[model samples]
Target: MARLETAYGPLPTDPGEQSRLFYKIYSAYSDRVGVLDAHGSYLAARDIGIINLILFILLPGFAWWATADVYRAAMYACALFSAYVLTAAAAQVYGVRLVENVLAAASADHD
Candidate 1:
């Protein structure tokens, strides 16, 4: 197993542990973004979960039904979903980097 060094100490490289760490960091960052209050966060998470379910599950089924071509429709739907996921991930990463840079600059100015 690998390890990551954080202010608290070293973290295990286990997938579950890594995922929980990531979620904690993400939740903190989201709070900093100020777009979501408690109720807003809950609603946003629920809406996003439903949208993802529809995109990955219902959309493909609908596509297959509409096209009557299981293989082609399913592949196309999967490709589209994959692209959407990648784009969203890239945007999230970019936003986090932007936030980090801004924070670093502000700290440097204070110093």
Candidate 2:
């Protein structure tokens, strides 16, 4: 698959004959990311309530600076990023399960 960069983000353009399959995967990934971003707002709210938003950013922000030569800030930021990924993954799993269950029930009724 070939990659194409647009206003939204990177997308697979050269799907060859499997464009549909490629798009299905991409759509799922996009949905997961969207869910993560939506849920991350709750986390942001909590951080804001505690006034730890800056602290969170600054702790590593400073540690990153203090360490020098390397990007400690990015590493610390990665901790939050990993959390977002896990959150997204869990939501996606739940979504898939919900869809499967619904489909199974519908099929059982028809049969």
Candidate 3:
């Protein structure tokens, strides 16, 4: 009988070095994707905000009156919709940085 051994795995790594390298690579990617620029930030912020607003506000309002609230639904709908929209807007604003960062990282890899 013969015994055979095989090794298949990621190579040994230095986590600290790997983290630093990935950070550098991510920065490079961001720059390539145009997220390094102020205009990119502005565009992402505007588009994401508008999308969240429509999805979280105007659309939900109709649903509330049509189904969720049977009495004085319009008022309840407006109130709930407003509350959700404000929170969604805030979160989306905060998320813009992550979006930009990811874009940059992706671009970096493409090169």
What is the clash count for each candidate, in the order shown?
0, 0, 4
Q: Rate the local accuracy (lDDT) of all candidates.
A: 0.55, 0.49, 0.53
Superposed Cα deviation of residue 74, candidate 1 (Å): 1.4
Order of quality (lDDT): 1, 3, 2
Between candidates 1 and 3, the one scoring higher on lDDT is 1
Candidate 1 per-residue lDDT over residues 15-98, each given as its tens digit: 998667655544544544332333354454455545664677667778888889999787978776775676556555555564
After the best TM-score superposition of candidate 3, give how far the Cα of residue 23 lies from its true spot, in angstroms.
32
**Candidate 3 ranges with C-alpha deviation above 4 Å:** 1-35, 70-111
Candidate 2 CA-lDDT value: 0.49
lDDT of 2 by residue, 1-111 (tens): 112222224543565734564444445543454444544554554444344434555576676678773566777767755655655555565655544443333334343
Q: Write the residue-wise lDDT of candidate 3 on 1-111 in tens digits.
A: 011011112322698864565465455555553445544555655665567566655655566657876565566656665765665565566456655565445544444
Give all TM-scores, in the order shown. 0.45, 0.36, 0.28
Q: Name the candidate, 1 or 2, with the larger lDDT value.
A: 1
> Which residue ranges in model 2 land beyond 4 Å of their true spot?
1-72
| Clash pairs (backbone) in predicted model 1 | none
lDDT for model 1: 0.55
